[model samples]
Target: MNSLSRMLEVLNLFKPEQPVIDIEVICSQLGYTSASAYRYVKELSNAGLLVRLPRGYALGPRIIELDRHMTQFDPLLAASRDIVGDLIAQTHLELLISELYDSTVINILQRSGADEQALNFGRGRPMDLFRSATAKVILAYLLPRQLKRLFDNAAPGDLERIGLTWKDFSKAMLRIRKDGYCISEGELDPGKSGIAAPIFDEKGRILGSITLAGNSERFNAFNREFLSTLMIDAARKITSRIAG
Candidate 1:
């Protein structure tokens, strides 16, 4: 990999569970020698992308600054904040505004209701493409070529767990497209169910998804048609607002 790509790989290692990593840990995890790990970490630290923590290394202040900038200027987030706020108020469910960037589904905006359980994801957190309702809606909208690439690169048996084969998975996606929404029950987080609908850009490209999440019991208590209609309407409104 190029130096830039290697640097990003290093940054990607710093996740929620392993937020602080030292040179030794990086070397072992990435199968790099001490020299290579130190070189990569040094370059990142020099660029202000990695900070030297007392224990190890953590994402530096630069990341936080960039996140702030993105949150302030992102068009979709700006357009949907108030609308999502309204959804949370109306349904009393946790609402997530997520987007498909390349093939990675990211939770970009979220609002939680008083009684709803908070999800593990947050702004910039990568949502599981195969698991979360928000991710599945976006996945269902991928171009054929994109879908093929994703399927080819995915870990084995992922398609099977979702449906059993490519044909089954395709049919499931078709159903989602026809209905304009998707619902998942305890698929990602146990006991948490979610309903999601896709948003499209002016060019009709899939932009992302808007999701309402709640405890499965609470979610089951609501009328399916009513909740799906509300989710679809919210997704459409966000799409239109951003497209405009």
Candidate 2:
């Protein structure tokens, strides 16, 4: 791979589950020679994208700087912060704002309900797009060709887990588009359910998804119509704010 591509590959190796990675691990994971792996890590560390730790390397302060900039200025998150809090207060459910980045669904921010501590959704963590209402709602808005490409690239087990074969998956995407929102049960987290709506830009391009999640029992107790309405409304408001 090219130097830039190799650097990005090194950065991508750090996951929420494994925040620190050394040259040895990178060499093993990427099947790179020791010298090549060290060169990639050294470049990233020099650029402030990765930091040297006693044990290995972690994401550097540059990431935090970028995150602070996004949290402060990202139209979607800034516009929807109060609205997400309002949704949590009104529905007594945890809320999250997620963005689709390079086909991965990333949790950007979260608002807690009464059981704040119990709501363990990790902020900035990448989630499988096929596994949650939050991500699926965004997927519902992708162009047909893009959707097909993603589906074609997916593993059979992932397709089956989402309960869709190729033919069925297309039809289900259509239904999600028609419904304007998605309801997922025990998909992302067992025993937890969520409802999500897509946020769009002025051009009707999908921006991301806003979701309200809670215990399945709590979701069942609340009015489904009300929850869906709230989720969609929040999404629209965020879209509008960004448009202006």
Candidate 3:
């Protein structure tokens, strides 16, 4: 691998569970020579991307600062904050807020009303549509050109099985645009259900969405049409807040 790629490879050796790890483990995982790994690690540490923690090299606060800077001016988050909070209050369930970037779901913020111990994500988490209802709603709203670009960048035949070709996909999107909500069962995760509605500005531009989410049993008992109405109402309230 190239130098930059190899440095990134070493960075991945640290996870939440093993936030600090040794050079030996890093070399084994990245298949780099011990000296090369050490050199890269030392460089990264000096640059503040990695830190020499008690255990080994853990990510430093600089990365956190980078993450904060990335999210500080994200318009979608600025626009949709209130709507998500309202959804949490009314449904007493969790909300997963995400936006599309480069056709992949990039930014995520979690909202919860209940204990939330059952929720498995957090603010600033990145998500995938293949694993979320939030992804489906965002995808259902993109223009045809954007959708084509997304497909071209995705696995050659991966999205075809999900049936989002231009013809049918446009129609599906129009439905959400008209009714302002999407109800899908077990789309985000096994046994999870979601009710999401698009949040639109006064100019009728779609910002993102507000989703009411819960695990299988609680979600299954929810009335889709009822949840749809709630989400649509929540979106309207949130849009007004954003506009103000």
Candidate 4:
């Protein structure tokens, strides 16, 4: 990795489980010498990306500030805010707006009714690559080359979850694109089901997806066709808003 990449990698090391990291841990995990690790930490601290604590270094307040900016200014979130609220009022189900960041699908916004089950997927969390309706709908609109690259790197289990072979995977994605939406049940979370439709940019490039999720029993009991149509219409509205 280049120097800039190495420097940025330090930020990736912080996770929910390991929120604080010391210099020794950084050196051990990143294979950097004590001197280089300290230098990186110092620079990151100076930039307000890391805050030094008595125990270790924790993520700094800059991340929170950036999150606030994204909440207020992200075009996708801004476009979908009212639309998502409307969907929640209509369906009384959990709703998510997710975007593909490189190869990762991240849920950027969520809304849920009071009686809804606690969802494993939440705002700012990464969704499953193959199992989530949110991710699947977005993936269906990806370029063939991009799909192939992800397929080549996928684990055997992940491949099997979608299909047994490359052709099968390709067919599944094609079907979703043709249908303009995806439905998944008990894939990412047991007893949870979702329907998702893709949103697009002005150029018609896929930007993200909007999904509605609920308890599988309740989801199946509802008029799925009606729900699906609602989700598709909502997604199109968000896309148009983005373009406008």
* Candidate maximizing lDDT: 4
Q: When superposed on Cα atoms, how far off is each prediction in RMSD? A: 2.4, 2.2, 5.1, 1.4
lDDT of 4 by residue, 127-183 (tens): 657778899999889999988988898888887767768999999999998888999
Q: Give the clashing residue pairs of candidate 4, or none.
A: none
Off-target runs (Cα >4 Å) in candidate 1 are 31-39, 122-124, 155-157
Highest TM-score: which candidate?
4
Instruction: For each candidate in the order shown, give its overall lDDT on alpha carbons.
Output: 0.84, 0.84, 0.68, 0.89
Q: Residues 1-244, candidate 2, lDDT per residue (tens digit)?
A: 7877876988878776899999789988988899988888888888899999999999999888998999899888889878977887788888888888988989898877665445555587788778788989998789989988899898877787554677899888888888889999987677888899999888989888998888888888988888888877888899999899
After TM-score superposition, the amount by which residue 106's alpha carbon in candidate 4 deviates from its true location, in angstroms, is: 1.0
TM-score of each model, paired residue for residue: 0.87, 0.89, 0.65, 0.95
Per-residue lDDT over 1-244 for candidate 1, one digit per residue giving the tens place of the 0 to 100 score: 8767766788878776898999888877777788888898888888889999899999888888888988898888887888887888887888888888777888888788755458777666886688778888999999988877787777765675556567777888888899999998887778888999999988889999989998888888889999999989888887888779
Residue 196 in model 4: shift from native, Å? 0.6
Model 1 steric clash pairs: none
> What lDDT does candidate 2 reach at residue 91?
84
Model 3 over residues 92-198: C-alpha lDDT tens digits? 88886655554566436676656445455455555655445566677767767876676566663546434556566466666756776777766545666677766
TM-score of 3: 0.65
Q: Candidates ranked by TM-score, best first? A: 4, 2, 1, 3
